[model samples]
Target: MDLHSALIALRDPMGIPFFPWLFQGLMVLTFALHILLVNLVVGGIFLAVYHHVKGGEYGRKLSKTMACCSTVNLSLAIVLGVAPLLFVQVIYDPFWYTANAISAWWAMVFLLVITLGFLSLYVFYLKREKHPSGFGFFGLFALVMVVFAGVIMSMFAMQQLLPEKWLSWYVVKGSLQTLGGGFHAFSLGRFLHFMVPAFVNIGIYMMLYAWYFRPRTDFDQGYLDWIGKSGVRLAKIAAMIQVVIGFWWLFSTPIKFGFYRNPVFLIGAVLGFLVMVALIMVQKDPERYAVPMGIVSLVAVLGMSAAREVLRMGYLGQFDYSIYQYPVNLDWGSTVLFLVTFVMGLVVIAYPITLVFKLGRGTLSVEEG
Candidate 1:
C-alpha cells in the first residue's frame, strides 16, 4: 500500500472522541507547562552539579537549593507530560504509534532511563552533605540520563515527521528490522533549539528566586544581589544563543516549506526575540522585573508551542493529513470529565503550592513560631 493509504489504515477506525482543534489546543498548552518544568529539571540539575564542584559558601547553598528544586520539578514535569502525550496520541495516532514502533526498544527503555535519572539525582542530592565534591558524578550522570531521554524523545518526534522513510527503517535491505533498536533519524539543530532554552528559563527562575526570598531575614542581601546579577547574565546570554539557534533550525528546514515566511513561525520568532530584549532590559534590575518578565517568558513559550504544532501540521500536510480532517466521534462525556479533572487537579495542588511558597519565604515558619 502507498504511504497515504497505510497512514489512514493505521488511524483508529473508531474515530477520535472529540474535535481535533480542541485537543490540539490543549496539547499545545499542556506541552508548554511540561516543557517549562522540563527546562527547570535539566537546567537546575546542571547548575546544582556545577556549584557543587565549585563549592564555596554561596555556591554550596545554591547547589543545595537547586538540587532540591530539580527533584520536585522533575516530578512535576513527568506528571505534566501526560496530558500532551495523550492529546498527541489522540490526534496523531498514526504518526505517534508508528514512531514508537520504529524504536520500540527505546520506548520501553525510556521508563528505566528516566527512573535511573531520578534516582541518580536523589543520590547526588542526599549524599552531597557527606561527600560534597565526590557525589558530583551522580549529578552529572543524572544530567546525562535526562539528556539521553530527551534525545530519544526528540528522535521519536522527528521520526513522526518523515512517514515516507518508515518502510525503509522498518525493513532494512530485504530483512525485517523488528528489533526496533535503530535510531533512524535525528535533527541536532531541532533538539538543541528545544534544549538551549533550558538555561534561559532556569535563569529567569533564579531571578524570581532572588525576588521571592528578598524579604527573608535569613537570606543574605549580598547573596540575593549576586543571584539577581548572575540570573540576568545567564538569561541574557542563553536568550542570545537561543535566538541564533532558532534561526539555524529555521534555515535547516526544507526551503520549500518556507517556515521563515510562515506567519505562525514568524510570530513565534518575534516573541522569542522580545523575550531576549526583555531579558536584556532586566539585566540592570532583574528582581524588579522578575514577575513581569516571567509572565512574558511563559507567554513566549506558549507562542512557541503553538508554532511547534503549526510546524507539525506542515510536515503532516505533505502526506495530505490534517487533524481537522480526522474522524470525530464526539464524546462530550469524556471531554467534560477531562476538563473537570484538570481544573480539580489545579485546585488540589494549589494548597501545597501556596504552602511551599510560604515556606520558602519563611512566612509559614514565622507564623507558627
Candidate 2:
C-alpha cells in the first residue's frame, strides 16, 4: 500500500483494528519506557565518569552509585524493549522482518555482546571492585555500545519499513545511507539531541538517588556532599547543552515544524525549561528543593520526551517505511484494553516512586550510593 493509503487507514476518525490499536498501545508504552531507561543509562554513565575523572572523595562514591543506577536502568531498558519489538512485528511486520532479516547476523550477534557487558558489570559489583579512576567505566561503555547497536538495528529496521518513495534501497549491502556506522543511523544533531538530555536526566536521578541514600557516617556525608555537587553541576551543563542542541535540531527540520503545531509540544518545552532551572537550584541544597524539583523535573522531562515521541510516531505512521496497512478506525475494545493496561503500568511505575519517597522520609534506609 502507498504511504497516503496507510495513513488514512491509521488515523481515520471512524475507527481502527483490534490488533493495530493493541500494538500501538504496546509500542507507545515500550517506547516511553525505553526512552526513560535511555536517560538513566546515558546520563548516569556520563555523570559517573565525570565524577571519577574529577576524583574528590564524593566523586569516588558518586561514580560507583551512578554505575549501580546505570546497571539497573540497562536491565529495565532491555525488558521494556520487548513490547516494542512485538508491536513492530504486529503492526509493521513485513518491514521489520525484512530489515532485521537482512541484518540478522549482526542483530543476532549483538545480543551476546550486550550480555557480555552486563556480565562484566555483575562481576564488578559482585567483587565490589575498587578504583574510582575507572569506576563504572567499562560497564557504562558496554551499555552505551549496546545502545548504539540497538540504534543501528532500529535504523535498519526503519529504513526497510519505509516505502520506496521515502526510502530507496541502495547498493549491494542493502544498508541505507550512512553518516557512519556499524550501528544506528547517526544523524549528527539527531543523535546529540538524543544523547545530551539523557545525561542531564541521569544526573538528576543520581542526585535524587544521593538524597535517597543519605550518608551513614561523617565520611559518607562528606562523600554525599561531593556527589551532589558534581551531579548538579553536570546536570546543569548537560541540560543547557540539550536546550541549545534541541533547538538546533528543530531548526534543521523544516518539515517537522508542522509536527510541533500541537500546543502540548510547547507546554513540554516550557516544562522542560523549568525542570532544568529547578535542577540548578536543587544543587545548592538538595534537601530543600532538589528532591521536589527533581520529581517535577523528571516528570516534565518525561512528558516532553513522550510528547515528541508520540508526534514522531504519528508522523512516521503516515510516512512509515512499512509497506503494509491496517484498517481505518481504532478498535473500540482495544482502547478499553489499553486503558486497563496503562493503569496497571502506572501502578508498576508508582512503586519505585513510593520507594523514593520512603527513602526521602528516612522510613526506608536511604543508603548513599
Candidate 3:
C-alpha cells in the first residue's frame, strides 16, 4: 500500500475502548491546562532571567519569585502533559509512532533534556544566594535547554500531521535511519505562534501576582507599582506581536476555506482581540480587574486551542482520517474510574498551590484599602 493508504488503514491498537470523540474532548481539555502551565514555565524562566539581569531590589524579588514559580510550573506541565498525549496516542498511533521512529533518539532523549533542564534551574535557584555569576550562567543555559525541549515536542507534534512527508524526512540521509535526531521540517512562524503566548500569559500572571499580593502584603508600594507596570508593558508588547504573528501563522498554514467561514475561527480571533482590550482596561485598577481579566485570558486560550484542533482535523480530512471515524467500544467502568481519579488529582494538586499563596499573603502585612 502507498504511505497515505497505509496510514489510513492503521487501526487503533487498543480496539477503540471508548468513543473517539470522548478522547478528543479529553485531549483538548487536558491540553488546554497543560499549555497554560507550559506558558508559565517557559515565560516565567525568561522573565526571571530578564529581571535578574536588570539588577535592582524589585528586579531581584521578581526574579526570585519567577524562578520559584518556574520550578513548580515545570513539574505541573509534566504531570498534566500525560493525559493529552495518552489521548493522542490512542487516536493517532500510526502517525505518532511513525514520527517517533523517524527520530527515535531525539524522542528518547527528550526526557533527559528535561531532567537536565530541571536540575539546572534547581541549581540556579539554590546557588543564586552564594554565587550570582553562577546563577546567571546557569539560568541562561537552563533556558536554552528548556526551549530546546519545547522545540523537539512541537516538531514531533506538527510532523505527525504531515504523514505525506514522513518517508522523505526519514530518508534524508540517503538511507532509512531511524535514530537520526535532526529536525527535518519546521516552521518559524509556528514555533513563534506557541512561544509568543508564553510571554503574554506570564505577563498577565505577573500582574495578577502584584495585584493579589499588593493589598495583602507589606511589599513597598513603589515596587508593587513597578511590577504591575512591567507586567502591563510585557503584556501589551508581546500580545501585539502575537497578533501579527498570528496572522503570519494563519496564512502560512494549509487551512481550508470552510474553516475560515467557521464560527470557531471568528470567535477565537474576537477573543484574542478582547483579551488585549481587557488587559488595557485593567491599567487603572489592576487589582480589581485581575480575576476577570484572567478568566478572559483562559477563555481565549481555550478558544484558540479549539480552533487549532479544528484546523488540524481539517488537515487530516484530506487523508480521510477523522477521530470520529474510529469505532466505539464503550467501557464505562474504566471511563468512570479515570474521570473520578482525574478530578481528585486536580483537587489534590490545587490544595498546596492555594496554601502557598495563603502563606505568602500571611508573610506580608496587609495594605489598608
Top lDDT prediction, candidate number: 1
- Candidate 1 overall lDDT versus native: 0.91
- Looking at candidate 2, the ten consecutive residues that score lowest on lDDT are 177-186
CA deviation > 4 Å runs, candidate 1: 363-369
TM-score of each candidate? 0.96, 0.73, 0.92
- lDDT score, candidate 3: 0.80
Best by TM-score: 1
Least accurate 10 contiguous residues by lDDT in model 1: 360-369
| lDDT (tens digit, per residue) of candidate 2 on 1-369 | 775564445443433456465566567557666766777776665655566577666665666676677778878978877767776666665456555554565576678767876776555444334554444456555656756655664466445434443334323357664322233233556556656777676666757666766743333666666656766787788888877876776665446446456576677667777767877766787644557766676567566555555555544555543223565554668768877897998899898888876755466653742
lDDT of each: 0.91, 0.62, 0.80
Q: Which structure is stronger by lDDT: 2 or 3?
A: 3
Candidate 2 vs. true structure, TM-score: 0.73
